[model samples]
Target: MTTRRRAAPDATRRSEESRRAILAAAFDLVGQVGYARLSIEGIAARAGVGKQTIYRWWPSKGAVLFDAFLMLSEGETGRPALPDTGDLEADLKAVLRSTVAELNDPRYDEPMRALNTEILHDPALAAAYAERLDGPLKEAKKERLRSAQRAGELRADLDLDVAVEMVWGPLLNRWLQRSGPLTPHYADSIVETALNGLRRPTRRRRDQH
Candidate 1:
């Protein structure tokens, strides 16, 4: 029953070139001067667009930076889908390993760190970031977990919402905290630990009994 809002056909849309320029400008400026010093004026100047043009598409500097972050993430993450091999452990590990690779990319590291700082400081911006950037990825993970639940591979009573967070939380923590290398070894360990906690307890065989 939920209705999704669709853009009006007559809506004034920025040209693809302009949009690309703006995102590129944001990325370059953030890398040069850092996110705290980034502004709509600077981006406009770099992109050769009027301030109104940037404002028309995004409400604030934070929003613009968030969009730029998403643009870069799309390029690095490439469609944000998890593997569904029917083996939940394997699928989870595979997806998390890919995530570790993205986090380790030098191009993304500084820009994402800047964006994360902004989100952490602003509650409203953080909510918007989660909805726009993280929501789709989390929903995909939830869907895959739900499939496993239906197959009796996961506990029926498990809260898939928390389960999704568990799958991602540690990886993000390590990436953000700089506590350890975000390698496949670390990713596999996180998956095994989380899945072991979530998996349904196997019933004993008749011969064992």
Candidate 2:
């Protein structure tokens, strides 16, 4: 009897390769041509796959773009965690500065703006964004805050969800609305202002007043 090997693994590998190619094509095309002009046909042509391939995996262009961005983020740094260097204020400043840099980067700026716009109108994409991208990042931020709480750097009673929002919301709003420049100075100011409200007051400081 001749032994026959299963081709399942090979097929799976090919499928995964195709998926990655599609995602990369979508990302590259969006960065090259703004989201307004991105199309399934363009992505399929660039990826060297049929239009049905993209549709089989993703429902719409927004879903493809979201996944493409998610893939880029994961490839860059596998679900980022906030730095907890024991000094909550300094750590937050560093993270915020990094965030400001990313927001200002041309490669990321347009794609991110497009994704945010999609989220507003596409409920399904919004849910997936929350679950896959935003949710994990928020939880990581909250964990850093919890560490600060445990170290007595932050108020024990501080609501972490609210605190996370307070630290990040303004910057997000500014970026989305184009109200102000996302500069390192703005990032530092945000950290300083948020820390003032969130930090546990010291007894010596209180005695001075």
Model 1: per-residue lDDT, tens digit, 1-209?
01224655444243656777998898888877877788999999999999998887887777777878777667765556667888999998888898798789866676788888888889997897788688878888888999999988999998888998898998888889999888999999999989776555566444466
Assess every candidate by TM-score: 0.77, 0.87
Residue by residue across 73-169, what tens digits does model 2's lDDT show? 6786666788889998889999999989999988888888899999999897789889888998999999999999999888999888999999999
lDDT against the true structure, per candidate, is 0.82, 0.88
Winning model by TM-score: 2
How well does candidate 1 match the true structure in TM-score terms? 0.77
State the displacement of the C-alpha of residue 126, model 2, in Å, after optimal TM-score superposition: 1.6
Error of 1 at 89 (Å): 1.3
- Model 2 scores worst on lDDT over the 10 consecutive residues at 1-10
- The number of clashing residue pairs in each candidate reads 0, 0
Model 1 lDDT vs. the true structure?
0.82
